[model samples]
Target: MRHRPATYLEAEEVRAILARPNPATVEGGRDYALLLFLYNTGARVSEAADLCWSDLQLTAPRLVCLHGKGRKDRLLPLWRDTVAALHRLRMNAQPDRQPHVFLNRRGEALSRDGIAYILRRHVQGATQALPTLDRKRITPHVLRHSCAVALLQSGTDITVIRDYLGHASIATTGRYLSTNLQTKRDALETFWQHAGIRPVRAKAWKPTPNLLAFLDSL
Candidate 1:
């Protein structure tokens, strides 16, 4: 498809994207806060768009419920800032609203493309600060991938990541951690060492000076 996301953004790039939207006004605040909600919750674009008022549980231990693929529901914890952003977004957009979390300028529920367009608008702004963004196709899915991979890099268990993404199989979620070849190599090397593989020294095979002289004479 024309909108396929090729890669993920680093944490810093995410910050740049968050800083793009001017939250001085309600509309700007909604856009800015929506990005935070996506990054912090690691929710899919559809999940974020499909969110209802009741899905939010913003309390001491903040959480949001996302209804994902296969009509399954997954609950994820939200950071304090994420909760704050959602509060702002809800206050501004849902003043008299009910079901959906995000709405268009016309007060209709946001569609997948609408969310993608919003992300793209901010991504272009982020490019100036994070030049690496220039090479990437940053979609809402990429943000989700970034969240999963960032957790992996920070040493979170793969199974936890699978559950976080509501993935049916760990193999499906493992694609995020597999992006780092070095991590895999390190793990394999550790396994080999623990398996009692002996390390060989190439220096031990070097010919002696006398042997080299005899070979030269021969």
Candidate 2:
């Protein structure tokens, strides 16, 4: 069956969701960091859930090694904000032997379901500030789609996004090209420029004499 175009959040909507988590508390900090990480790296929910401290390089040239499908691993650069949020989460975390980057109230590694629940809760809370979010079904994978679209909008190469998302084929990444309205508008503008097609304004319409006579008969 054909799948629908992926649902994604605009950058501002993403910012609103990220703001929902109160970073002052441990769980709140983790939730924020988790959401930021998903947006930053376009990681699959499973990859994010399975992340470990050993998978990260939090220092200069911050990077993460995401273990993807079929044991394929890809390295992604971390955004400065992502690094900062993660740092705060680490500092606030209760001392524990858990190696996972994200943990629950019981200090166990967060499962994929746990991550989804966190995203859903935050999305609901964010809806008050961004009513548009209420119309979209936001999920962890939607964040992945949003990341890909954001990269495309910023002029990042499609192949780079393919590898960034750890897609086995470039074809999977190409789907993002069709989902962005701004990208389509840009393409159309470029096409018009190259084709020498000048936009013409439509003349205002008035009823024809025959049509006016017919209406008058009624």
Candidate 3:
């Protein structure tokens, strides 16, 4: 079966969702960091859940190494805001030998379900400000899709997105091309300008005399 187009948030909607998390409180701090990390790296919930401090290079040129499916590992650069949120979260984190970066209230590694719950809670709050959020079902994976579409809209190369998302084939990442209408509109505008096609309606067609005679004969 063919895959459905990805469901993703617009950049403004993503901002509204990110704004829902309060970073002043402990749980809020972790939630903020987790959400930012998800958007920044486009990491699968499993990858984020399995993330370890050792996998992070949070200093200058911050990066995270994601261990993806099939034992494939990829490094992704961390945005400054993401790094700052994570740094604050780390400072407030309790001392533990547990290797996971994101933990539950019990100080255990966060599960995929836990991540989904966090996203749902914040998205619910975000919907108050941005009603569009309520129309679409937002999941942790949807955040991943949002990240991919956001990157595509910014004119990032598709091959790079495929690598960034850790897809085995570029075909998987190409789906974003069809999902992003802004990119399509921009492409159409560019084509019209380059091809010298005016944005005017075509005149209605009328049958020629020879064509009418041929039809009457028939």
Q: Which ten residues in a row have the lowest lDDT in candidate 1?
A: 195-204
Candidate 2 C-alpha lDDT tens digits along 61-172: 5778789887777666676677898889778554447788998888888999999999999999999998999999888988887676665555555555566677643232
Q: What is the lDDT of candidate 2?
A: 0.71
Local distance difference test scores for all models = 0.66, 0.71, 0.70
In model 2, residue pairs whose N, Cα or C atoms come closer than 3 Å (at least 3 residues apart or on different chains), thus clashing, are none
**Per TM-score, what order, best first?**
3, 2, 1
Encode model 3's per-residue lDDT on 1-218: one tens digit a residue. 33344576666677788888899998999998998888777788999999988888889756787899888776666766778998998896654577788999988999999999999999999999989999898888887776665555555555566667776422325465334323433432332232211233323334344433322221
Which residue pairs in model 3 clash with each other?
none
Model 1 CA lDDT for position 14 = 78
Off by over 4 Å in 2: 1-3, 93-96, 168-218
TM-score versus the correct structure, for each prediction: 0.72, 0.74, 0.75
The deviation in Å at residue 94 for candidate 2 is 6.8
Best by lDDT: 2
Error of 1 at 110 (Å): 1.1
